[model samples]
Target chain A: MTTKIIYLDHAASTPLDPAVKKEMDAIKTYANPSALHQLGLEAKEILNNSRSKIAEILNCKPEEIIFTSGGTESINLAIKGIAQNKGHIITSKIEHPAVLETCKFLEKNGFSVTYLDVDKDGLVNPKDIEKAITKETILISIMYANNEIGTIQPVKEIAKIAKKHNIPFHTDACQAGFLDLNINADLITLNGSKIYGPKGIGILYKKKSIQLEPLMHGGGQEFHLRSGTENLTNIVGFAKALELAQKEDNNKIIKLRDYFIEKVQKEIPRTFINGHKKERLPNNANISFLDVEGESILLYLDHKGILVSTGSACSSEKLEISHVLDAIGIKHDAAHGSIRFSLGKSTTKEELDYVVKELKQIIQSLRMLSPIHLNKEEIRK
Target chain B: MKIIGYKQDKAWLYSNKVKEHFFNPKNIFKSDQELEDYKNNADGIGQVGSPACGDVMEMFIKVKDGKIKECRWRTFGCASAIASTSILSEMVIGKTLAEAKKITPKDIVKALGGLPARKIHCSILGDQALRKAIENYEGKK
Candidate 1:
């Protein structure tokens, strides 16, 4: 008999919700929203309604929202659109590749970018953002929460500074939407897949009067800013997923996540937690096991029908230490041993129990083979 | 069985033995003295591949009146590499230098029951180190 797989890598992506799937199925048959016909009007109405629902969840106006492909596109549009408008940009080093790479691109294009460093907890100090701001700074983009470590940033405080400086602020809120909507951002980007919505659909919340040059030029659909035919089905599904995820009382998930963390800490010796102790996302528990490679642990767990992620998915191809771990100053030994366990709305106590049991066995087996680990008795002698 | 290009079906599989040695390797040795004392005083002294390439091993030897006396090793590599070093140290502890010189990488691989194809190099490294240490002892004489 095949063993059931326990998925603990929800931060990577989530299974589509049944309600979200139903909404997408209903909207799939609609014609293009930009077409000038009765069917097109129906599609347009669905698209507009989804936008309004997303905006309401974000505590912003419907007109402030623009649908894009996903987190990457939303980040690109926000960063690049603002870079095209003015001089310099300010961002943090712990941002996702979408924001970091976009900032690099802007830098290459003669737009200066100041990459502020985060604390050991993977949080950028708002005062650092304020101190880095110059008269030439046109925009300040920091992530709402880190995708790897799940440390929530002080976006509201940073936004206040950006407001005082008359600098537009953007936040990649892809990892924060499932938790809270205390954004207070001039521009915010959120992805559907991160919140169990459809992939390829996201919302970029651009406050009214924030002028952004269009990334694409064509049909003038999204306020002549992002020109394209609307992805009605995925957008509808995204909105439904967002609304459902936000409406639920997530304290239970948080409690279960803490329980798992407690179990792991108690069972596994020398396991170090890798993010902000309390201010981290409720679903995230990133830890580093001394003297064991994360890939080896991940593969061994995979063999036992359990799934987990390393610090960064990007390093899976090259088998190098994660950049996020490096940015947060995790040394080579601890960095190589890091694992990220991100719980989801569907994660249950039974799954957590099974994971803890299997993890103890796997860690013991792996540690036995590691050359770096010596017993306390041996070390003392 | 030949160590190189040996398929799992054609050769005996020894993954379980390799894993056993990897997890519970016996005769682990450490030193603060010169390399020669550890080499001449132990049962066997085996130096394997370089550590820079992620492969390294050192096995110690002690001989008394032409009879092998003691053996210990230190290895820095993957699970199979370290296991091969430990198994080779065990295989050569009681053998004279002449007999130990005849021990090939295949013999070490066979002594460990068997090794995977990618791990054949580790056994080869162990064999080369043991022979080099034997050569070093002979030159002293």
Candidate 2:
């Protein structure tokens, strides 16, 4: 019998789909796309076809999608590239560190970046973005969906404002693409690993009109924008994964997500949901239990073979609370107790049920031992 | 749960004493009133760290006739850190200023039975905050 482990942390990274794995395996037996030979031509054909497939899913032209290393590189290239040309940028405080840190580096280099705050639900007002825009503002880089809180932003409205002001709009859609292909962005970043694709593959969608100062300089690959020989296998797998994720019924995923949320909320008291209650990603459910640390809860669940995330997996090593949590104005005590449960196409009700059961036990036990809770009780008495 | 760090490992895993403090801290106390009422007011207060750094504490001292009459604290940190602060406050109360100055982070940890190695910083933070508060009190007088 196979040991059952409920894997609910898809937002961190998903296992490669069997179909994507097969596609990757097939690509391994190929010549480099850059070589000058029939095999190379065949490989080039496969690569271009994959790119076109991904573009089709994203509702963008094939030529606009430039493959890169992953989400981090894509975000860095998009932010730094635009910030170098234009000295000012506007972004939200809820953005992933990939975008936030890149902005910080740009700021150190004399670029002015306005980090707009988000509402309690982690939604950035497009009005705020518009108001923050200055004559020197060249880019507005916001995330389509937050990784930790799963709050979706008003990218379409923000994009419209950017277009009206003749500014480039870049959104890191690595989390959003797992739900849909709503490419309401001038420049969009997507990562393969976030959607059951092979790791080390990502795409940057750039409209033809926007001019960017290139981050990489060398062999004029990736239309002279990104200079590197592509990891063909991973790119092929990434495209396949995107294609599959896009084709699936998003409503089904949303229903499952809702069911899980409903169950958890009903069973667990003092549980507060993070992010927008309705305008969130279909597969994300972030919640914080009162009087408990998320790290401790995660450790307990991990021992019971129920894997979930306390915060962004990328920044888990940092002791500070998540920037996403802070942006939504969760109190420090509650922020430290936040947990993100992101689902995937493979997730099921049975798995969610098991996770809910395990979480209730762990949270109750942890709260009992919490000094904060005890202190509150003492005062109550 | 698997303990990840050397500090937590050294302080939590092998020692039953550290676990006792972490799970069941003694001297947990809270007071919302300003420290102004006491004749020997704990005016010079100090707070270190914030929610962002995962630990926050406020330490206050009341002095009478050149001796420490009372010490009180409030903290928002991990169990070991909070417990250590609470116990440290209780330990230093009624002691002379000179004797209280000798109290180190180790003393706070020892008072809590023993804090986990990872949690030694809690004691350190509490000690620093308390010492700084004392220094501020001294500066005023």
Residue pairs with backbone overlap in model 2: B7-B117, B7-B118
Best-fitting candidate, scored by DockQ: 2
- Candidate 2 runs further than 4 Å off: A312-319, A374-381, B1-141
Query: What are the per-residue Cα lDDT tens digits for candidate 1 across A148-240?
Result: 898998888888998888889999999887777755788999899988899999889999979888888998999988898888889899999
- Tell me the tens digit of each residue's lDDT in model 2 across A1-381: 234566789899989999999988886446878888988888888889998998788787888888899999999888887776538989889888899899998888888999999888889999998889898988899999988888888888888998899889999998987665564678899998988898999999988887766778888778889987778898899899898877777888899999998999999988878889999988899987776666666756765667788862213223467777766766556677778888888787777777888789877766543434322222110
The C-alpha interface RMSD of every prediction is: 12.4, 9.8
Candidate 2 clashes: the total is 2
Question: lDDT of candidate 2 vs native?
Answer: 0.76
lDDT of each: 0.76, 0.76
How well does each candidate superpose onto the true structure, as a TM-score? 0.77, 0.76
